[model samples]
Target chain A: MVRHFMAALQKHKMCYALILPTFFLVFLFRYYPAFSGVYHSFFEWDGALLEEWVGFSNYIEAFQDAKLWRSFLVVIVFISANIVKMIPAIIVALLIFHLKSEKHQYLYRVLFVVPMIIPQIVYMLLWKFFYEPNIGLLNQLLIGLGIVEPDLPPMWLADPEWVIPSLIFMGFPWVGVVSVLIFLAGLQSIPNSVYEAADLDGCGILKRCVTIEVPLIMSQIRLSLVLMIIATLKGFERILIMCNEFGGPNGAANVPGLYMFRMAFMEGRVGYACALGMLLFGVILVLTLLNDKYVRVEK
Target chain B: MSAAPKWKNVQQELAKHAGILFVLFFAFFPLYIMLQASLKDNAQFGNNIWLPMAPYHWANWLTGWLAIKDFIANTVIVCVFGVLLTLAFSITTAYVFARYKFPGSNVLFYMLLAVMMMVNVASLVPLFTLLRDLGMLNSLISLILLSIANGQVMCVYVMKNFIEDIPKDLFDATSIDGATDLQVVRSVVIPMSGSIISTLAILRFIATWNDFVMPMLIMRDEQMYTLGVGLMSLNSGYDTQWGPLMAAYCIASIPLVIIFIFTMRLFVKGLSSGAVKG
Candidate 1:
C-alpha cells in the first residue's frame, strides 16, 4: 500500500506543482483576510497597533447606533429598487424574445448588452455629471419640456431627500443588459411545446406572459433576485463615487459597505470596521441561504 | 373579422417595435451623452447639451489622451499580466481538481467555492491591511495579485466544469501512449478548451481593466493609477472641465467597446455561464 501510494504521488507530481501557487495565493489573500476579519473584529486598534481586546463592544455599539441601522435601511431601499427594476427587465426580455425574426432579436440583443462593456464607474460618473443641478442633461430636458423652472430645478444628488431617489434613478429604465440576457436565456429554455399548448388554449400575449412565462422562468427570476441582493449589499462603488463625499448629504445614502470602508480607511477605526464587515458578511450569508432554500422549495 | 384581426396585428407589431425602440434609447442615452459632451467645444457647452453638432472639439481627445496615457498603460499591463497569471494558475488547479483523486482535493475545492461567497466588500478591510503590511501598497502588482486571487474561485470553478465535460477516454488514450499527465493536458485538454479559454480570457481582461474599487484602494500613487482611478482624479481635479473629462471617459472606454463589438457572442456566453454557476 505504501509503494502504491508513492507511485500515485509520483504520477501526479506535476498536478501538485501546478496548483501550489494557486493554493498559496488564495490562502494568503482570500482565506487569511476572511478569517483575520473575524479575529480583528474583537480587538480595539489604533492604526496598526492593537490597543486592547474588546469583546462584543463593537457589535454592541453597532446595534445601538441608529446610523448603522439607518444604513441598513438605505441598503434595503436600494435592494427594493433593484427588485422593482426586474419587472421591466423581464418584460423587455420577453418582448425581444418574441421579435418577428431572428435577425431582429440578434440585433437588439447586441445593442442592449453592448453597453454593459462600459465600465460601471464610468456609468456612475456620467450620471453624476447629469445630476449636476445646472447643466445636467436631466435638468436641461426638464427645462426644455417646461416641466420645471430653470432657476429652481431640483438638486438631484445634492439634496438629502433626492439623493437616494436620484441614485436609484441614475440607471433609469434599468433593465440591465445582464438581467435581460439571463431572462432571455430563461425564456428561450422553456420548451416550445408549452408555448404551443398555451396557444392552443387561446392564450393572449399578456395571459401567456403572466400565467405561462412567469411560472416557467421562476429559476431565472430567483437567480436575478439573489444576484441583485448580493450586488446591492456589497456594491458601494457607485455610492462611493456618486456621493464622492461623506455618504451623500449627511448619511442619507450610506450603506454598510461604504460605512465600513470609511471607518477602516478614513477614520482608521480598523476594529469597528472589521465588526461592520462581519455584520455585512453575516447578512449576505443568511440572505443567500434563505434565497436558496426559498427557491428550492418553490421548485 | 379579418379586418379587425389585421388591425390588431398591426397594433401589436407597432407596440413591439416601439418597446424595442424605447429600450434602445435608454440603453444608448448615457453613452450618447458621454459622446456628445466629449465632442462639445467651450462655446457649445451651455448652448445645447443634446447633440455635438458641427465645429466639434476633436482636439479634446488629444488633450485627454495626453493627460492619462500612462494610466492607460498601467491598466493594460495589469490586465495583461493579471489575466495570463490567473489563467495559468486556475487552469492547472482546475484540471487537477477535475481529474486527479488527490487527498483533500474535495475539501480544498469546496474551500475555494466557499470563498466565492465571501468575495465582497467584507474582505476589503482585511485585504487592505494585508497589502499594507506586505509593503505592496501603491503597486500595480498588488492589484494584479489581489484580482487573480479573488477571481480564481470563479475561474477554477468554470474551468473545472469545462474540463470534466471532456471525455475520459481522450486522457486515458494519451496516457497509454506513454504520455505524461502534463503532456496529455497540453496535447488533449488545452486544444479542446479553446472556446472556454477565450471566454475566460476576455471576461478576466475586461473585468481587470474596468475594476474601480480594487485599483482605487490598492494604488495610492497617481502614477500607478488605472484608467478608472485616473478618471476619478480627473473628475475631481478640475472644478468642471466636462469637455476634457468626458473626452477621457470616451477614450478610456474605446478599447472595451471595440472588444465587445467584436466578441459580443462569446462575451454574453461567458457572462451567462459565470452568472449561472456562480
Candidate 2:
C-alpha cells in the first residue's frame, strides 16, 4: 500500500506541487496556532515572558471561576434572544414568497438588501449612539411619548438592567437579508404543483403554509439555527464595541469570548485565556453536534 | 366573478403591501436618522432630534473624510491584495484537487474541511503569539496574509466542486494540444468559473472589509488601523460630535454600497446559490 501511494505521488507530482502553497499557509497560520493554543493552555505565561508549565491548573481555575460561568450564562441569554430574532426574517420571506406579483417580490427583496450595504461596525456604533443617555433617539422618543421625564430617561447601556435588553434590541425589525434570502431560496424550490394540490383541497392560506411551505423548508430553518447558534457563541466584538472592554456596566453583558479577550490582551493572562477559549470551543462543538443529531432536516 | 369577492382580493393585496411597507419603514429608520443627523450641528440636533434641520452642516463630511481617509486607504490595499492572493492560491489548489487522483487526496480534502469547524476565536491568543514571534505584529502584511490563509478554505471548497463540473472534454482537448497544467488552468478553469469566482471575491471582500476584531487586535499604530477600527475611534472621542461622526459612518459605508450597486444581480444570485448548496 505504501509503495502504491508513493508511485501515485510520483505520477501526480505536479498536483502535489500546485497544492503546496495552500498546504504551507494553512499549516503555518491555522493549524500551527490552533495546536499552540492547546499547548499554551497548560502553562503559566504572560504572552511575552515568564513561562512555566502548570498542568491542568488553568483548566481547574476556569472551572471554579464564577465570573467565567456568569459570562456563559449571559451568552445563553443572547442565544435565546437570537432564536427569537430569526422569526422576523422567516415571516418576511414567507410574505415575499406569497406575493402575487413577481415584480413586487423582486422590488421588496432589493429593498431588504439595501440596509446590509452599511458596514457592520457602523451598525453597531449607530445602535450604541441610540442607547446614549442624553440626546439619543430612544430616550428622546420615550420623553416625547411621556413615558419618562427628560431628566430621568433610562440609561440603556450604562444601566445594568437595560444593558442586555438594549444589546438584543440593537438591530430592530431583525429581518436579516441573508436569512430572508435563504428562506426564499427554500420556498422557491417547492413545485407549483404542491401549492395547486393544496388549493384543490380547499386549503386556506395559513393552512397551506403550515402544511406545505414550512415542512419543505425545514432544512433551511435548521441550517440557519445552527449557524446562528455558532455565530452567537463566538461573537464578542459587538459587546466589546458597544459595552466597552469590561462588558457593560458591572460586567452585565460579558460573554466567555470577551472574557478570554480581556484576559489575553488586557490582563496578560495568556494561559488562562487559552483555557477559557478551549472551554468555549468545547461548548460550541457539543452544541453543533447535538444540533446535527436532533434537528433532523427534511428533504 | 362577484364584485364582492374581487374587492376582497384587492383588500388582501393591500394588507400585504401594508405589512411589508411597515417593516421596511422600521428597517430604514436608523439609516434615515443617520442621514438627517449628518446634516445637523450639535445645537441643531439638540433642538430638532427627529426631523431634518436647516442650514445643513456639509463641512461635517469634510471633517469625517479627513479623519478616516488613511484608514480607508489601508483597508482598500489590504482587501484588494488579500482577495487577489486568496483567489490565485485557491484556484490552482482547487484545480489540482478537482483534476487529479493523488495519494491521500481524501485525507487532505477532509483536513481543509475540518478547519471550517474550528472556532476562530479559540485560536486568537496563540495566533497572536505566533504572529509576534514571526515579527509580523502591527503590520498590514500580517492582515493580508492572515486574510488569505483564512479565506482559502471556503474558496477552495466551493471552487473545487465548480471546477470538477466543467466538461472533461475541454481539459482533454487542452492536454491533447500539448498544454501544460498551468496553461490548461489559465485557459479552461478561470474562464469557465467567472461567476463563482466573482461570487467568492465579493464574499471575501466583504468579510475582510467588515472584519473588526483581528484588525483591532493586530494593528497597534493609528496609521495602520483599518476602516472598522478607525470608525470606532471616530465615535469613541469624549465630545461625541454627532454630525461629523454620522458623516464618517456614511463615508465608511460608501465603498461597500458602491460595490453592491454594480454587482447586485451577481450578489443575489450567489447568495441564493450559496444557501442552497452550503
Candidate 3:
C-alpha cells in the first residue's frame, strides 16, 4: 500500500503542485491559528508579549470565573431563543409551499429574499437604531399608543433587565430567507404521490402538514438546528455591535463569545481568551455530536 | 360538495396568504422604515414616526454618500480581488481533486472538510496575532488574504461536486489533444462550470463584503475601514443623525441589492442546492 501510494504521488506530481497554494493558505491561516489557539491557551501570553507557561491555570481560572458562567447562561438562553426563532422560517416556508398559485409562490419567495440583500451589519444597525431610547421607533410607537409615558420610555439596550430580551427581539419575526429557502427545498422535494395519498385519506391541510410535510423535512430541520446552534455559539459580533464590548449593563447580555473577545482584545488576556475559546469549542463539539447521534431523520 | 370544498380551499389559501403577509410585514418593516426615514429630517422623523413625510431630505443621501463612499470603494476592492483569487485557487484545487487519483487525496480533501466544523470565534485571537506578526494589520491585503483563505473551503466543496458532475469525455478529449492541465481547466472546466462559479463568487462576495469583525480587529485607521466597521463608526457618533444614517444604511445595501436584482434566480438556486447538499 505504501509503495503504491508513493508511485501514485510520483506519477501525479502535478496534482500536488496544483493543490499546494490552497493547502499552504489553509494551513497558514486556518489550521495554524486553530492549533495556536490551543497552544496559547496553556500560556500567560498578553497578546503582544509576556508569554509564560501557565499549565492549565487559564482553564482553571475559567472554571471558576463568574462572568464566564454568566455568559454561558446567557448563551443557553440565546440558543433556546434561536431554536424558537427558527420556527417562523419553517412556518413561512410551509405556507409558501402550500400556496395554491405557482406565480404567487415564486413572488413570495422573491419578496422573502429581498430583505436578505441588506448586509447583516446594516440590519443589526437598524435594530440598534430601533432600540435607541430617545426618539427611537419602538419607544415612539409605545408613546404614541399611550402604553408608556414619553418621559419614562424603556431603555431597551441600556437596562439590564431588558437587554437580553431586546437582543433576542432585534431580528423580529426571524423568518430568515436562507432558512425559508432550505425548508422550501425540502418541502418541494416531497413526492406528489404522498400528497395524493394524504388527500385520499381525507387529511386536512394542517393534519397533512403535521403528518406528512414536516416529517419528510426532518433532515432539513435537523441540519438547520445544528447550524443555528453553531452560529449562536460562535456569534459575538452581533452583541459586540449592539451592546458594546461589556455586553450591555452589568454584562447582562454577555455570551461566551463576546466575553472571549473582551478578554482577548480589550483586556489583552489572550491566553485566557484562548482557554475560553477551547471551552466553547468543546461545548459546540459535544452538542454537535449529540445532535448527530440523537436527531435521526426518518426517510 | 365540489363548491363547498372549493370555497374551503379559497379560505385556506386566503389564510395562508394572510399568514405569509403577516410575517412579511414584520420582516419588511425595518427596511420600509429605513427607506422612509432616510427621506426625513430629524424634526420630520419626530413628527411622522411611521410614515414617509414629503419634502424629502434628499441631501441626507449626499451626506451618507460622502461618509461611506470610501468604505464602499474599499469593500469593493477587497471583494473583487478576494473573490477572483479565491475562485482561481479553489477551481485549481477542486479540479485536481475531482479529476485526479493522487495519493492522500482523501486525507487532503477531508482536511479542508474538517475546517467547516472549526468555529472561527475560537481562532480570533490567534488569527489576529498571526496577522499582527506578519505586519499585515491595517492593510487591505490582509482582508483579501483572509477572505481567500476562508472562502476557499465552501467554494472548493461546491465546485468539486460541480466539476465531478461534468462529463469525463470533455476532460479526456482536451488532454488527448495535447492540452496542458491549465489549458484544460481554462477550456473545459471554466466553460462548463460558469453558473456554479458565479454562484460561488456571489456567495463569497457577499461574505467578504459583509465581514466586519476581522476588518475591525486588523484595521486601526479609519481610512482602512470596510463598510461594516465604517457604518458602525458613522452611527456611533455622539449626535445621531437619523436621516443621514438611514441613507447611509441604504447606501451600504445598494451594491448587494443590485447584485441580487440581476442574479436573483441564480442566488436562489445556489442556496437551495447548497441546502440540499451541504
Candidate 4:
C-alpha cells in the first residue's frame, strides 16, 4: 500500500507542482482572511493588537443599531430600483433583436456597449458634476424645459430626500449592455419553429412576448435577477465615490459595505467592522441559497 | 392583406428605430458631456455647461496628463503584473484540477468555487491587517497581490471548464511520445487554450483597470495612486477644478476605450459567457 501511494504521488508530481502558487496565495490571502475575519470579530482589536475580548458585543450592537438598519432599508430600495430598471433593458434587447437587418442590429449593439468601456467611476463623477447645484447640466436642462423653476432647483446629492433618487438615476436609462446582450442571446436561442408555431396561432408581438418569449427567457431573467441582487447587496464603490466617503449627507446613502469600510479604517473600530462584515457575508450566503432554492428551481 | 401588413411592418421598423435612438442618446449624452467639458475652460463651464463654449481649453489635457501621469504608470504596472500572476496561477491550478484525478481534487475545486460567492467586503479588515503585517501596506504591490489572489477563483473556474473540453486523445498522444505532464500541458493544453486565455485576459485587464476599492485602501501616497484614486484626489472638494477633472477623466478612459474598439467581439463573448454560464 505504501509503495502504491508513493508511485501515485510521484506520477502526479507535476500536477502538484503546478497547483502550488495558487494554493499558497489563495490560502494566504483568501481563506486565511475569511477564517480570521470571524475570529477577529470577537475581539476589540485595533489592527495592531487584540485590546480585549468583546464576546458577542459587536454582533449585539449590530442587531440593535438603528443606523445599520436604516442603511439596510436604503440598500433594499437601491436594489429594487436596479431590478425595476431591467425592464427597459429587456425591452431594448427585444427591440434590437427584432431589427429588420442584422447590420443595424450589430451597429446599435456596438453603440450601446461603447459606454461600458469607460470606467464606471467616471460615470459616477460625471453624475456628481451633473448634480452640482450651481453649474450642473441637469438643473440647467430642467429649468430650460420648464420642469422646475430656477429658485426651486432640486438638490441632487445634498438633501436627503433627493440623494437616493439622484443615486438611482445617476445611471439613468440603465439599459445595461450585458443584460441586453444576455436577453438577446436568450431570445435567439429560442428555435424558429416555436415562433412560427406562435405565428400560426395569430399571435401578435406583444402577445407572443408575454406568453412565449418571457417564459422561454425565464432562465436568463433569473440569472440577471440574481446578479443584480448580488451586485447591489455588495455594491458600494459607486456610492462611496458619489457620497464622498461618509455615505452622503447624514449617512443617507450608507450601505453596509461602505458602513463597514468607514468603521474599520476611518473609525478604528476594526472588530465592530468585522462583525458587520460577517453579517453581510451571512446575508449574502442566505440570499444565494434562496436564489438557488427558489429562483432557479421553477421550470 | 399584403399591402396592409407591409405598411404595418414599415411602422414597426420606424418605432424600433426611434426606441433604439432614444436609448443611444441616453447612453452617449454623458460621454458627450465628458468630452465637451474636457475641451472647455472652467470660466465657460458656469453659464454654458450644457454645451461646449468658445475658445476650447485644449491645454487641460496636457495639465491633467502631467498631474496623473505617474499614477497612470503605476496603474499600468499593477494591471500588467496582476494579470500575468493571475493567469499563471489560474492556468496551472485549473489544468491540474481538470486533468489530474488527484485525491481531494473535487473538494478543493468546490472550496475554490465557494470563495467566488463570498462577500469580499467581509474580508476587508483582516486583509488590511494581513498586508500590514507583511509590510506591504500603501504599495502598488499590495494591490496587485490582492487582485491576483482575489481573481484566481473565477479565472480558475473559467479556464478549468475550457480545459475539460480538450480532447483526451491529444493528451494521450503527447504522453505516448514520452512527454512529461508539464511538457504535455505546454505543448497541447496551453497552445490550444488561446481563445479562453484571451477572453480571461481582457476581462481581467478591464476589471483591474477599473478597480477602486483596493487602491483606495492599500495606497496612501498621491504618486502611488491608480487612476481611480487619482481621480478622487482631483475631486477632493478643495477645488472643483472642472476642466482638469474632466480632462483627467478623458485621459483615464482612453486606454479602455481604445481596447474596447479593437476587441469588441471578444469582450461581448466574454461578458455574455460569464452571465449565461453563471
Q: Candidate 3 residues B180-253, lDDT tens each?
A: 88898899999997767887888788889889899999999999899999999988898778899899999899
Lowest lDDT 10-residue stretch of candidate 3 chain B: B269-278
Model 2, position A92: C-alpha lDDT score: 88
Better-scoring candidate (TM-score), 3 or 4? 3
Q: What's the ranking of the predictions by DockQ, best on top? A: 3, 2, 4, 1
TM-score of chain A of each: 0.94, 0.96, 0.96, 0.95
For model 3, report DockQ.
Answer: 0.78
Counting clashing residue pairs in each candidate, in order, gives 0, 0, 0, 0
- The worst-scoring run of ten residues by lDDT in candidate 1 chain B lies at B269-278
Superposed on all Cα atoms, the candidates' RMSDs to the truth, in angstroms, are 2.2, 1.6, 1.7, 1.9
The alpha-carbon lDDT assigned to residue B56 of candidate 2 equals: 93
- Model 1 chain A: weakest 10-residue lDDT segment is A290-299
The better-scoring model by DockQ among 1 and 3 is 3
Q: Show what share of the native A-B interface contacts model 2 retains.
A: 0.71
Query: Where is model 3 more than 4 Å wrong at Cα?
Result: A1-7, A296-299, B275-278
**Cα lDDT over the full model 1:** 0.84
Query: What is the TM-score of candidate 4?
Result: 0.96
| Candidate 2: Cα lDDT at B61 | 94
Query: Stretches of candidate 1 above 4 Å error?
Result: A1-11, A297-299, B1-11, B272-276
Candidate 1 residue lDDT tens string, B1-278: 69998898888878997998897788789999888888787668888888777788888898889988999999988988999999888988888898988766788889888887784677777888888899998998888897788679888998898899999999888888998666767898789987687778877887898798878887878899999899888888656677777898888888888877777776667655533345
lDDT pick, better of 1 and 2: 2
Off by over 4 Å in 2: A1-4, A296-299, B275-278
Q: Best-fitting candidate, measured by DockQ? A: 3
